[model samples]
Target: MTELLLVGIGTGNPDHITLEGRKALQGADLILIPRKGPEKSDLAELRRRIVLQSVRDGMDRVVEFDLPVRDPDLPYLEAVERWHDAIAELWAVTLAAHPDAHSAALLVWGDPSLYDSTLRIAARLDPTPKVRVIPGITALQALTAAHAIPLNTLAGSVEITTGRRLRDTGWPDGAETVAVMLDGACAFETLDPDGLQIWWGAYLGMDEQILSAGPLEEAAPHIMRIRAEARDRHGWIMDTYLLRRTGVPG
Candidate 1:
């Protein structure tokens, strides 16, 4: 049976990779890097840099494959499921090409346990490879650190949700603070700005990082404008934000 290592590399920063994550990368017999199209070529390049930095030998073990794109026409959940199946198939095919490789590794952005689907896709492998996870810094941790703020106000609760959920279901009831990820749309615009404060960061832990914060009403438009400009310049973006309601004691 093959061993699959899911190594968290954090948000595109080579330094964010933990010592354990680097060791996992070095130990793998095969390293699979996904090419996410021209718009996001930088992502693949970043992974390449990490592999080069971590793996001192057998550069030939590193492999690149095209990532499957989701069909926008299909329902969201259905599209994601289908896309994941395609990725699993690709992984199986790649692994089959190198029968001698007993250990394979994939570098994950941020901690694999949070808002990541790599583990789920690995489950679809027919032989069910032995899975190992090497944790790394997460975007949430990077965001809070970049802004020099705690995830939650003194002893208050924090709810982590996606941008789509925030736009669809509104703020989670009784959550003093909410952290939103995978938000392509500025979902914060949908909420009433009253009593809300926002701390937003994009490209967390990278040199291209940008940050914004303040009362939601005052900061929302600025965040929206800058987000658009940054996406235009960089061709893609990954962002996260924390929203806290007023009346929560600091």
Candidate 2:
């Protein structure tokens, strides 16, 4: 019975790791770290650092495997399904190499419950392993904390959505605030920006973090420039932002 622990490492900051997550890392028999190509190798490196600094070394083995790349030609959902299947096959193969290990762990980027695919991929394993999720700080928390702003207004509801959805749907009904994630494009530009105030942050908890806030109209261009410049400098960037409609009642 392999116990698969998905430990959340939090948005690129090792200090954001929770005590429970640290304990899970220590308890694992093997830890699988995925290498996402040279451009994103820093991601894998972060997990490596976490395992090195936290995991009790005695009998625990840390294994690094190359992650499967998704085909861009396929439709979004189809490509995702194929990608997950490939990853599951990769995982099975990785696990087979270390047949003696009964328990394995993977360090997730943020709280696995929020927008991460590890849990979904874990479900695809054969004779499925018992899954345990240890939570960590989320990008949303990092964004709000960095700006020192409340995610919601007085008694106002927040709609957590992706950049694509926001771009397609314009603005959601009922919710006074919309927090956007996985937005490579500055989708907020599609909105009227008449009464919306946006708080944007990139590399949320990392050393090169950037924070910007103001009325969407005034701040949108600045965020776009900053995001582009940061990406140019770092070769990659992870960002999230919150958009609030001004004058919305509680």
Q: TM-score winner among the candidates? A: 1
Q: Which 10-residue window of candidate 1 scores lowest in summed lDDT?
A: 54-63
Candidate 1 regions exceeding 4 Å error are: none
Model 1, 92-179: lDDT tens digits are 9999999998999999999999999999999999989999999989999999999999998898888999999999999899989999
Residue 127 of model 1, lDDT score: 88
lDDT of 2: 0.89
Error of 1 at 96 (Å): 0.5
TM-score for each model = 0.98, 0.96
User: Lowest lDDT 10-mer window, candidate 2?
Assistant: 51-60
Q: Could you give candidate 2's per-residue lDDT for residues 1-250 as a string of tens digits?
A: 3899999888988898998988888888888889999988889888888887787592258888899999999998899999999999899899988888888989999789998899999999997999999988999999999999888888878899999898989899876899999998989999998999999998878888899999999999999998999898888899999999888763
